[model samples]
Target: MNFTDIDPDKLFSSTDNSNPIMWLVWIVPIVVFMFYGQRIQLQITSGEISKNIAKLVKYKEESKKELLDYLQTNLKATPDAAKKIDGFLEYFTIMPVDFDPNGIIPKIKHLLRSREDYTRQQVKSLSPNMDALEVSKVQNLLEVTTSLHLLHKLVRHLFLTAKKQNNFPLILPLQMMIPFIMEQASALRDAVSALKQGQPIGDGIGPMVVGKMMLGTEKKTITFETVCAEKEFEQRKLYLLKAEGPTATVGRPGDAVELLVLKNKPDIIVMIDAALKLEGEDSGSVAQGFGAAIGGIGTDRFQIEEIATKNNIPIYAVVIKQSVKEAITLMTKQISDKAESVESQVFQIILENTKPNQSALIVGVGNTLGVPQ
Candidate 1:
């Protein structure tokens, strides 16, 4: 056991090379390192993402439950209404509607009618009784609430699935994108609140302008309660089209414009709508361009494009810029104040684009929530 009796080579090579203990000694720490490394990576990548996902999911559930309770208590929704709501919720949650060209308007119309019917039935079951307008407002609120809930639920599901798979690469992009999703969800929540209180949102700027123009003029119903009024502006006959609102609908603008073109054969077609602004763009800024300014499932834009092409009419677009949050939520003072400026810009565009005494069909597109015609 003395230093002189010890041999370094024998001490180091005492075990056979094939010995299992020799392999274990070398392999166990490496395996342990890999396991702990994976855990660390998961913690670093998925911690914030998981927390945000949970927050979003919880918010959606609470919001959905609150809206349902409000419908049942305040709106007096019956069991039948509840079933219909569940159906609507399931449809959206399972298969979200997206932009498509084929028969999208009809599909939207059908959905709207279904929603209206459900709301009507609920209102009918009320003991204290509510008016049709009240029912319409409630229906709109429910729709917004459903959209918000569905959006949050979808994001939460995606995040949870990624986390379950322990996919750090997949999780990074999701984590980066979640803030924007949450922002939109928060805005939608604000929008739902505004709708419940029957307030116009920033996107209603177009309709508000058109509605003001309709005042003191004869309004003719075109389609789906959409109305058009003719007025003379700068020696040209201006036909302004908008949804008959104060209820919640974006009326069938495409159909209205098509009908008007056939009847009046307007020299020019002009459309006004709210457009999403980029980071540098200021809210309420007006931009003039060509083509349909309408935003939806492409049906309306397609219809307008077809009619404009056939009639050889130049289509002009006047868009007011706003952020997504501003577009859906209640109208800001800036948006409201800019309405007149937008109107002036439209007039300028019409005058510059069309010859004097020529007829022009101007359609204001977007939801006419609190805007009256």
Candidate 2:
């Protein structure tokens, strides 16, 4: 074992294979690992994936159970309501073709309206005893259930396909995404209870703040499930818009803004909404920016931007930060307390940007569930 006793001549010896013990102890295993390392990796990762898939299945089942429990306990649904709900799970929509990109917004808008109407009708028919607010919550509950079902089926399909094919590349992506997908599924699972109870979520902060702001002001229903409050704050005319709340819907902020702009002719548009916080960012932080400030498919954002741009109105945004999970789940104390801070910041933005007698349009964008004007 001395350094001087080491043989430099045998260090790179190709003839070392002649030693049976050396070959068995070192070379054989190295050769085996070299040939099968990826296979071993795939097997280990696949095992992990199988465990995650099991968890996903559990979450999916739990969500469906929560839905059925709500139906039976809250709505006194029939015993065979389970069979009726199964049909809602398989509902799918065909997206409008974009071959002609022009006029796509109207097309997409029409489809979205149709989908919402159809879903509402389905929810109403299933829960005839439920009121308007209950109907909205039930519709949202059904959405969460449907999403969990789809998530489980999709992940299971990929898992089986990759396992069957013995394909490492296919499994690699799934392995990497397992953590995120699990987080989303878990969040969705928890959101079921929140939605069913009509609790305010992180996303509701916008509406909550604006709902408070417009407390003494007269409000109008501008569009489908959307509301606008006309108020004068410190010599500035303010047009505040938010989803009509205590109902689980985002409403149509874009249409509301467009209608308000044409009718009232605001000088500046300020939007408030809950934005997704990056990792390590504080959950209840507030940030300022510009533009539509709306989420989802970007159609509504586009509509708002078009109206603002056409009218030469400056668009400003104030955002409350929260994570994806917090947005849908019950409102955290940290996030809920930001309502006051965001309200002050919004007033600051309006005062700093607009002069006295100038009209400012403020739109609070998010689900208004459990928060009312």
Candidate 3:
């Protein structure tokens, strides 16, 4: 009752083990956490990760199903055709040694070309009646399916390893990455539909602009799957280069650029493509800068840069901004509608940069899906 009357000995004494409330309040929690805390936390974390992994699996399976359906319904292929594609999904290529880093682009390009041929051949063999356009579509669709499959496999592998090792730290990175992984997988899933329909994607904005420019002009094949056409604007000769399309292919623009540079001795090289927008940047916004502006395996960019630099030509770039998702998925009305403005910008760049009798090379660098030469 009084400050000095308290029992000092009782305050420091051990708890009464006989009291159930004390055990429930302190001892029980201490014992549980000391022994099974990680197990409980693991179950909680694993449950969340497993839920996302299930979604990833669904996306992968759906893509695979779509491809099989396309094979049967469109190609009129046998059921074994689906099996062949399933086998193809696991195909991979080893990159050439980059230790020296010289002449690696050619080796990389060769390996990529071989892989592309193999992919096209596999799709072609199943349906000899399918045209080149059909083959390109099927090949693109197959790539989307294969990418989803690989993502699913990689995520599952991480999940299993974390579970097996009973290590929460090991799994934390996967947890952090699941959102990005799912974002990409969802985009890949959306792409399957566009590829199946042979619709243009945001990336096609580049080609769409140039394709419109090349329309009603005399066109010639400059390289594999690439075409070039010439036009006169003001007093300058504009040589338009783009992937030959209405098919899902980004042709060898590098070779096309090299050939054109040597042939015409263009005063400037301008490359246009769809670029990824920053977090706050408006989609479909047009931006211009100086560079090759090509987005791919970098071989094209290298070639474009090399030839432009060697010829003492200034390289200019005009880009339409969009997200990776938008670039690969269906061409949004916003992007498709922006092509006209982009074309105007290209013409302006040519007019302001070059003079009479000077030739300008313009490259529409992207997957020219649904955009014809």
The alpha-carbon RMSD values of the candidates against the true structure, listed in the order shown, are 7.0, 2.9, 4.3
Tens-place lDDT per residue, model 1, 1-373, is 6899976665546466765665687777788777786666667767776677677667666656766676777767666665656565655312236566565556765675575566557545642445645666666666666776677677777777777887767666776788898888777666767777778988888899999888899887888759889999878999999987887678889889989999999998888899999999888888889999999767678889998999899999889999999998899998889878878888888888888879888888988888988
Q: After superposition, how far is residue 79 of candidate 2 from its true place, in Å?
A: 4.1
Worst 10 residues of 3 by lDDT: 8-17
Query: What ordering of candidates by TM-score runs from best to worst?
Result: 2, 3, 1
Off by over 4 Å in 1: 1-38, 72-74, 79-83, 92-132
| Top of the candidates by TM-score | 2
Query: What would you estimate as the lDDT of candidate 3?
Result: 0.89
Clashing pairs in 3: none
Which model, 1 or 3, shows the larger lDDT?
3
Candidate 3 C-alpha lDDT tens digits along 161-243? 99999988888899899888998888999999889999998899988889999989999988899999999989888999999
The whole-model C-alpha lDDT of candidate 1 against the native structure comes to: 0.78
lDDT of 2 by residue, 1-373 (tens): 7999977667546687686666676887899889997788889998898898898889878888888898888888876778878988898888889999999988888898899998898777775588889889988988888988888888889988988888888888888888888888888988987898899998999999999999999988899899988888899999889999989999988888889999889999988999999999999999999887889888899999899899999999889999889999999999989889999999999889999999898888999999999
> Judged by lDDT relative to the true structure, which candidate is superior, 1 or 2?
2
Q: Order of all candidates by lDDT, from best down to worst?
A: 3, 2, 1
The weakest ten consecutive residues by lDDT in model 1 span: 89-98
